[model samples]
Target: MTTSPPASATPALPEPTPTQSEQYSLTHGKLTVGDYLPKASHDGKPGAGKCEWSSHVSVALTSDEIGALAWVLIDSVMKARFGPAVQLYDVWREHTLDGTTIPEPDRQTIGSFVKPVFGLPGADKKKSKDHLHGHIGEWLWHLLTKDNPTVRAQPAPKGDVTDSGGDGYTIYETANSELRFRLWESKKNTGKGSLSTSLNQAYGQLGEHGQTYVAKIVGAYAQASGEGAAELNSFITEIPRAWTQGDVIVGAGVTLATHRPLPNKPFKKMAGKLPLLDKPGQLRGLATSIECYEELADTVRRYAWTAL
Candidate 1:
């Protein structure tokens, strides 16, 4: 593991102007895309309208990359549902009778939990929207943290429950040496108005209810058993020393322009029309436009059933 730098260390800032955009291949080649026009510096101590802000644009994902990413995402869903140590037999046994009887409603849901990526999931009993949000939340988590080992899945609550402020949460030690906690919320929409509504709600959670949510996730992981548990406990236990007051950050993943093709309007133009939760310094944003959303669902379902 790369040792985190001292909290006082000056963290490397994003390029004010990325010449050709930054390309990355993640999830073992499951995702390959570029981040363009990144704005790292914030004006006036990190609030809106204080700095020269530019929203970054993501290069459209290829079919293969999207397929691969779906696999990784579905794998995460399985892990979140069944724990990271889950196996092929475990999935097979739980969803099947004997060894060949597939459950009804749709075999694809079960297959979605373990299959390989071909396309995204289709509707099943009116739960497709919720399912899509869950997968996208996990996918966003992996994208932001690069699948940090310490990141744990927040199991889906049993029964018809709600009020979970965010879709997912995790804590990591920043290279700047501060232990930073991030709360993730993903919103999927096809149009700008609906997407903005969702994005605003997510931002609202991060702004108004962020601290309490952070405490809840910290408390849960602190008591849980895992390789990350000890470190997580230590970080939460010593919150005073781990971070200066008001140093935490919030992030949101918004799916925009989904109704249209890939490479939608530049991030700046879209972002200009949207509300800012706070200063760019305290918030991070991942704005994406998923072109083949239905295919993404199918791909996730495919990976869930196909991969061990």
Candidate 2:
């Protein structure tokens, strides 16, 4: 008879081999993603209509929601580059105002606020994935779940930031007082490949490295001040054990082709094999599929140019 391997002898998960990336040049005042339904046919017929998505899922593009998202993105960017407790308005004014005595930001100033995040040369370059991933994280924070500034501010680095790991993390209290940790990962497909490709990449990222990244960031924040810093710090020290002993939830955000229809049934069938951490009898396996216009980045830039 064979004996079971000891805990230490158990192998850590393997690293994820993400798909090859493509590079695209950034265009000014252009958007690459937005509301658009992909072309689909029922029984070999082509048509246009509302694509049925998972229940209760929709994107908010109203002025109010866009403005809120802008603020959050700006604040999160600053907090990640600098630290928490930063006043984003001041930072925006500092960079855009250039010593002017403007009490409030105008349209031009608003564009300036987002330039670092979206305006820089090649910010949304063809191969870049950070912008899409970071934006999805922000979208989930505001639209689906309660806000967590630290996770949102996790910095969309211009380069080499994806390796920074732990796209996002949050803590929740169960009815019985047990703690559960939720982690998120995102993938964007520029229509060069099927949506399934991006979804698979996201699921792989979460399974391979989500826990380690969360533990690292949580440990850092735990030493500082925040809503759950102290508790997170203690949890980090315990690590693999802490994660296994308690509940851990994983979320994946996939950006798919907007021109084609995505049926929920087949999508679920495909995702069934993912190594999600959502436990039995617990809310787990959170995901969102975003269909973007061909010019989402341009649209966002125009919005910022007009709104700020």
Candidate 3:
């Protein structure tokens, strides 16, 4: 099943022209951002405090655009686990350096490296679904955070196997020049289940294990020797306390592929789920419902293999 904007809505934008780059870059101007939940409903609400409603954005993309995005992002996805200097990155840079097409042999080499990371094309059904859906959700959140101007987010750690910890992290600079850290957990609902239930699970996981997740990523912050590095490191070092002190923002988001209409209040139950961060602008929720999600995942996988 597929869902698209109504005829009265704005016309679909033209596809973007691909740019030549040494490193993978996000294809901007293609994502459609709109309100998923109303602001009036959240006012003075328990789980929904006075957070930046604008910050809670929803994204929609055409199938072709999604496939192209996967190609553009494959390098960064590879680098997330293998580092920036991976052989595949080198091969891509070399090919695009002269505006020439990558040779067939080179494409094969790229596919070889990519297939193992994502799993063979026709691998086990359960494992393949898990890898594809989980990575796609994380990737969507990464793109959203990167495009957001108010926060500087880290790329998700793309491990070959699932690991315990938060799904995403970011730093927000308040108007007062204070640094605030955010830990995010992302979930995807591929089954015929409730989106709120998935979100509740994400919040529960974060409430129980968010500290350990923050602790593990403290070293990654050390690489930021630029301004605010010291303060950021200190904030991350004190996890649960930082969350309590209003210096840390905890968020959870769920992505679903559905043809059904979304609930008017997707995140109404958030405050009751995890009441630790009840301050205004402290608890955040994102709900991304896409049409043909499983098909998109398959398309993304195909595009990734041919991205050389």
Looking at candidate 1, the ten consecutive residues that score lowest on lDDT are 15-24
Deviation of model 2 at 290, angstroms: 5.2
TM-score of 1: 0.54
Extract clashing residue pairs from model 3: 47-271
lDDT of 1: 0.43
Which 10 consecutive residues of model 3 have the lowest summed lDDT?
A: 32-41
lDDT (10s digit) by residue, model 3, range 1-308: 99987878987654332232212233343332221211222234333343222223224555455544554445456656445547766665455344355689876666555664466444533454766776766766565556566674465645542765667777776667655677777777777777767767876777777767776666455555677677666666665566545343444333332323456666566666666666656666555555556655665565444344
Q: Best by TM-score, which number?
A: 3
Q: Pick the candidate with the highest lDDT.
A: 3
TM-score to native of every candidate shown: 0.54, 0.52, 0.69
Candidate 2's clash total is: 27
The C-alpha RMSD of each candidate to the native structure, in angstroms, is 15.2, 18.5, 7.6
Q: How much is the lDDT of residue 305 in candidate 3? A: 41
Pick the winner on lDDT between candidates 1 and 3.
3
Model 2 worst lDDT window (10 residues): 16-25
* Candidate 1 local lDDT, residue 41: 24
Q: Local distance difference test, per candidate?
A: 0.43, 0.40, 0.55
In Å, residue 24's CA in model 3 sits off its true spot by 16
Estimate the TM-score for candidate 2: 0.52
lDDT of 2 by residue, 55-133 (tens): 2223434432333333333333444444442465455435432423334644344345455545533443443544644
